[model samples]
Target: MYTTKIGLAPAIHDSFIASEPLGHLLQSSKWQEIKDNWNSEIIGFFDDDQLVASVSILIRPLPLGFTMLYLPRGIAMDYENTALLDYIFEALKKYGKSQKAIFIKFDPAIQNLPENEKVIQKLKNLGAKWMGLTAEMHDTIQPRFNAVVYKADFDEEKFNKKTRQALRKARNSHTIVKFGRDELLDDFSEMIQKTEHRKGISLRNRDYFEKLVDTYQADANITMVYLDLKALLIEAQTMFDQAQKAFETKETTNEKKIKQLENACSKAKKDLSVLTDLVQANGDIVAVSSALTVNFGTHTEHLYAGTDTDYQKYYTAYLAWFESIQYMFDRGAETVNMGGLENSLLETDGLLKFKKNFNPKIEEYVGEFDIPVSRLLYPIVNKLYMMRKTRI
Candidate 1:
């Protein structure tokens, strides 16, 4: 019989997940550190004393001494193997019931492949419910559709037009910090708050930001992307001065050098004009936008980002994303998970449109499923949950 263990050492979980293909950050123990707000457990399933599957399950306390077991982008395992999934879920249900959990909610990262349909049908036959793909935001705990950047043959000649533009602009301009200073976090949080306010979405607290970076520490897994606008302004001025001096030089011939000088002067002037405008608005140096990425396994996840409301015209967000893509790609990452977009190709949300710059493939997960400990309480709790969630 297969066996399961709870609250195992992180090394055990790490080793198991690392051996698998592209373990999600949510399934990683690193996420356990960041999600300190919830009670968590590292679970492992074994066959003949050899580890077969592992997951990080978060427990949320509910009313009347009951609990809800939630796995965010988790139950990370081989979805194709029905035997493994059947064994693991049975163990999980038994353990969840023992822990007074009313239900166990799972949203695996499995896409809706043709072969995957067989697995879904098998799960249904085994009494597992399926939430059919829906574009509604509240239909699932996480977005059903996500933008995934796959590792293709790196062709320098054929880049997405927007990717090319963002890269060129970033390369020619200011600094892109991988891990910015602590002081920059406050600015980043403020920017996020302002953006969230404008968009009418709920905003996270500042401590959430601090804990995420601090939990990841200075590891390559957590990449913080930000721009030093002051540095760009100063560099632009220097380039302008150097270009002007070179143009006035006597040694310069009226050939290709003259054309080069003219082009340099023109670019420097335009950059100066843009930089000067930004500097005048924000002061000596300021962070216009910032993004935090979590690198785990073979993929880098672009988790959260925000732009200064005033500096949107400068396209700092696009630049930040471009540099982040390059950073992960350079380090041999297999994919860049650009995060979620609502289902539906016709959706014109700005978030989806912005992430579309990278020409990402839309990965659709088959929403969430719930395994209830008590069938009688399931509908009651779900109705209450829907009511409360809708109010949000």
Candidate 2:
């Protein structure tokens, strides 16, 4: 038998959460604070008097005096363990009745692997309903398909080879800037609006981001790819000067030194050309591309992002992600989740193509599940859910 309790010691919760191989940022305690409007609870499942599994449930008032139980990225537990899952369902149903929960929804972080067939059977055996496999972003609370960058034992430089190329091209046109509570709400809002307009997608408001940044503190950051033409021009002139000095040095004729000098001079001239063009076309900052990221345990996730399309030619967005990845590496994070993509498997998906530039592999999860507390109300709620999704 297992015991379900609300709120454990801080260390106990943190240790188990960090240890889950499939853990996610959404499950973090800080996230509970961000969703201030929702009634959130952290439930720990104990077996043999040891803290075994945990989950964070977000409850929102639904129609007709009922509440909806949403477990973002699902309950953090070993889904393959039948006994453990049995206890989880029992506890959730009992807890749901008291809270007037209509049904419990979960989209765990489990990936789609060949061996997961047995696990899928267990989920079914435990009376959980399966849902969703669409390529479109709609119809799910969290993305079912994700691109996670998890190679930490390897070289960060090798990982950044493509980013270095973007930096080389973007060097003379822009710079990367990271911001926090520094009035980023307004800037991010503007860029977010622009990106939504161009991409035909709906994003959250600035107020929501304010809460995210305010709550997550050390775990969250706002990074801007600032296209400052003046800064680029100054940097270009400095590089050109260095190249000129190196060309005039005594080692210019030495074969090894000559090769190095040529490479430097060639890069300086190429960057100067772009810088001159940018400075002439625009002054000061040409664009501001920003990305928001959160880190938990060994993982870092890039969430909402905005880009000023005017400077897309300069690849400022790529530079922004490059630096974001670097930030994760500096913190010794084992992986970086570059956010969501569609599972359509379409080779031409623009988002997929863009993320592929960073050489990240696509991860299609085992899919979402519906753990019904009241089987009678569960089907009724499904109809209402479809209506809500369409309205959105």
Task: Give the clashing residue pairs of candidate 1, or none.
Answer: none
Could you give candidate 1's per-residue lDDT for residues 1-392 as a string of tens digits? 67888887888997788667636778888787787778888889888798888988888888898999888877777767778888887888888888798888888787888867876777677666676776576678888888888768334346677667666775555545554536567877877787798789876767887777777665333333445778878888998999888887848566887898888899899989988997788776676667776667677787777776566655677767766676777777778888877666566787788777776788887778787776778889978987887786
lDDT of 1: 0.75
**What are the per-residue Cα lDDT tens digits for candidate 2 across 91-167?**
88888888898788888888778887788778877888887465556667787788877655334356456656776
Pairs of residues clashing in candidate 2: none
lDDT of each: 0.75, 0.78
Worst 10-residue lDDT window, candidate 1? 218-227
